[model samples]
Target: MSGILETQQLTHIFPNGKAAIQEINLSIKGGEFVIIAGPNGSGKTVLIRHFNGLFLPTKGKVLLEGEPITKDLTEARKKIGLIFQNSDSQIVGQTVADDVAFGPENLNLSRKEVDHRVKESLEAVGLSDLANQQPHTLSGGQKKKLTVAGVLAMNPQIIVFDEPFTGLDYPGVLQVLKQIVGLHKNGHTIILVTHELEKTLAHAGRLIIMEKGRIVRDGEPSQLINEVELYGIRRPYGQNRSVETMTWLS
Candidate 1:
């Protein structure tokens, strides 16, 4: 099967003349749960921003299912969903219902279809009751939930999450984790970027670590747990990483 996403000799330079990422080559398959762990400014965010053509490479190219994503950014985004670290930044609609329906509406789906998706997504995220509430008025955790609901409504095959657990309390984390697992079960490729290994380590099938804007390690979760801390990431606390942790994550 073709990789759902691929980057060929991908290199990116910011306007400041700093190279954000260099020679990134990746083949992310469908329905895989991947975790990207690295320190701040390691180019993890910049790299993923290319998957859906949010940040086109200064050189080389990004491909979605073997087609250049930049050529069809709108269609590429429909297949690859991106959830940023800051939920507040992604929330644009005034009310929760309107926000969740934004993507479907953009797709030009009929009103009945859009409404069905909005209701289903809100219920899935446990935010059905707050459908009419203003997005800016929701609590921090609620905002995060709202953000996920919007992406979920899009029904993308590959979902990229940047620091998914940010601003989430313990219960909130569990809630989000449950939703992530559900997405995985539904066959959506999950590419998660975060430093919090303990919360997500157990569910991830593969782990990739970056340092200084380059991929340093990529392997099964069981094989690389002890090695990530050297690259500014903390190992997950209190886990027997010797055995397969893929099931643990699920």
Candidate 2:
């Protein structure tokens, strides 16, 4: 897989003159499952927002397929779908089916095409049976899956999940983790941001640890697993287990 998403000297500064992310360069190849972990205030969220053009860079540029993302914000967003940490914030439609259809509808797709996407997306996430149910009535894990289905409906090539497993119970975490792994296995590039590594580390091909406003480490999970605690992320392995066994899924 070639480089599908990239950042060049990317930096984002808030209105108060605080730089959330400093000059950082990164690349994400197609179909790679990457885990980005960091402590609070490490700029993980700010960095991923630039990928979808949600937050423009303050100093440099973000590129999608070798072209600047700013060149076409619409195309950038369509190809790079973002699932926010809070599922409630992403829920807008009165029902599950309507919420999943929102993205395709906003793109002005034909009614037939929108219906097709909604059906396929929901099926992909195992929410087809709940199509007519209210989104608020779903559980936390189900809500996360709903967000994933919404993003899938957009036909995104790269999916950026920000703290996907947060606020989930044991079963909920497993449910969402299975959905994420399924997405990666089906050839969608996955960039997952979270401080909790044990829950999903085993499935990631690469690991990136961010500190303060810069990328402190980037490489294979096993190579950097030992050093994650230095940056305030808990080490998930012990003598009985290794990086490959650090996941919650069986």
Provide the TM-score for each candidate, comma-separated: 0.94, 0.98
Weakest 10 consecutive residues of candidate 1 by summed lDDT: 241-250
- Candidate 1 per-residue C-alpha lDDT over 8-79 given as tens digits, one digit per residue, 9 for 90 to 100: 999999999999999999889888999999999999999999999889899999998899998889999888
lDDT of 2 at 190: 97
| Model 1 ranges off by over 4 Å | 239-250
Put down candidate 2 lDDT per residue, 48-108, tens digits, no spaces.
9999888988899998999998999999999999999999999999999999999999999
- lDDT (C-alpha, whole model) for all candidates: 0.88, 0.93
Q: Pick by lDDT: which candidate is best? A: 2
